[model samples]
Target: MPRYLSILTFAAALFCGACQNSHSDSKNQSSPEAGVKPAFVAQRGTPVLDGSGSDDLWEASDWLPINQIWAGTLPKPDDFSGRYKLAWDENNLYILAETTDDVLLDVHPQALEHFWDDDCLVVFLDEDASGGTHEFSYNAFAYHIALDGSVADVAPDSSFRYFNDHCLTRRIARDNVNTWEIAVRIFDGKQYKDEGDNVPMLLKKGKKMGFALAYCDNDHSAERESLVGNVPLPNTQNKQQWLNADVFGTLELR
Candidate 1:
């Protein structure tokens, strides 16, 4: 695993812009609420990674609505509505998120910079369920999935870290509505030493892992309008509490 020195440096660089904003003014600030318990059904078969959610696994999975606002006021029904389904196999975890938005935007094209400024979905996971670390641990992983289908990580080096040797597949669609599908290997509580390694841990039934989901909404503005998350992210006015694994909720493989 990488040292905390590098992780802190990367976090500082990534969140420097947030320091300028005074969070004391709570006019538009959002807060996380209690999260819902959605059982992760085991995949019956391998679902295609395309953006279309037409597979049998998705049909059987539960679509949990994402309505909590973590950093802005409650959004109107016409503004946005999102729901996601979860399924896991022995080697990988699958996610199919369908969102309804009036406008689809992706201003930030770069992989590692300013992804939150555009519409994006973020998934935080602690594979080992160890929650004492304030910094990113080997077990914790944060994935930023941009509207353009770019995946970026902020821990273990920050700038576009690849999982499963970039075997992850993601697709995005923009029409009257926007939707996305993603599949990535489940990481063990170990770091990939080099390009030659392909180590992964299987998620079994009844095993618990720390998990959280979030989405960023930017409606063609200079800044994002909201940072909606599934779990509470307290003390975010001063720091980026989302980076800490302790803030995430528990996910049991069922």
Candidate 2:
């Protein structure tokens, strides 16, 4: 079986909480019935793609926490914690994630096969905001940032066999803190062909996109112990939300 099908099959056994909010874009502005949908402020200048969090541009951005766990109750701050900030220029969207984990486990070298099983950061992006069942379309994008500073695009089916070279990622781990910086080219939804043939998507004020953030934690184990995300995921009753784009929160360009 294919990787996506295998994941979907596995997700069928997991359980999720009841959804609280109706699907609406404006509800994302404030606290919505579903949950708080954080917004990413646009930056006038691009920040350097270094893993260091010393950029002045990130100083003005808001840090959204990744708190919702897939199965167990929320963990304490001392055990594990993660927060991310976002900024976008004309060409690309920049993301910075600062995470604190007592144990950093990264054993997967091939991103397409086992990155999710390791300690990593995953971002889901629905570029067109269509909110359709994107099983076959290349409308959504999922970028996996491994703890080893390797990056891979996991969305749009084709990425299962191919790796994305356009997206840039960097990471720095010291003590219990891990900092990651990523730059993903914004592509025009109309002309997107594959992960390789990406055209820069021009984002303007008030433009909305389907967005979600997640963290995978593995403590020297064969599989991840917890999968935490910012938004409520689908098929949580039986499976993880790594493949579902429709459950993502709204992200408005500012």
Candidate 3:
């Protein structure tokens, strides 16, 4: 991956803004995340970033079901189903998810538009596992990764921004299953800046952070049909993860 990919992504975002974004809070970080969140362990290893999940290192991890319903109705297996595996190294957090959706759609090519309404993977992250309302800040990020490999999130300014550089991804679909492999640079939400030069953190063992994973499924519709999460969430029927980081799950770099 290009080391300065974030710069390119940001530049492209600005260009898109020339063509034509609620995100309303700008704290560096927030209070400890709410609730006794689910704890997950990420084994230490580096896997090939290729969408093909053929690496032997993956065997060290287990597939965690991303089956919790956060919105809409529970989709049939043939319609939608997902599970993921996690692994990490000093530079990045790696996620491997296998999802089956009868059809994939990304109507909004513009990242700033209704990104969630399309078929995408939304990754919720709290840098320190200390969460609060980050709707308007970098204290956390809700990365909506589109099928085209573009990543979208609300910047501190509350404007839609593409964080494509933060996430290096690849997707391979075969036999109805789309395997997504993502390598995410762990940035301290408090230190990340859109116009300023920033660096990713060097992760270590036992490091804890708040995170959650989900998918928005839109099978030929004006909007998404279902939203599924990896962990059980409070107010299971209400989707608060986009605004509240307190509802996220905790992860430790093991």
* Top TM-score model: 3
lDDT value, candidate 3, whole model: 0.84
Candidate 2 segments exceeding 4 Å error: 1-32, 35-44, 71-73, 153-159, 234-238
Q: Which stretches of candidate 1 lie over 4 Å from their true place?
A: 1-45, 133-137, 157-167, 172-174, 192-198, 234-239
Q: Report how far residue 91 has shifted in candidate 2, in Å.
A: 0.9
What lDDT does each candidate get? Answer: 0.66, 0.68, 0.84
lDDT winner, 1 or 2? 2
Off by over 4 Å in 3: 1-36, 239-242
lDDT tens per residue, model 1, 1-254: 46998899889977764544433332232322323332233443468887778888788876766666677656676577777877777766777887776676788686566777788888777777776553444567777777656676645443455343433656665654666777756666566443446567766777677777788877878877777766555554325677667777777767
List RMSD in Å for every model shown: 12.6, 10.5, 17.3
Candidate 3 local Cα displacement, residue 242, angstroms: 4.4
Tens digit per residue, CA lDDT, model 3, 192-212: 889778889999999999888
Alpha carbon deviation, residue 74, candidate 1 (Å)? 2.9
- The superposed Cα distance between candidate 3 and the true structure at residue 44, in angstroms, equals 0.4
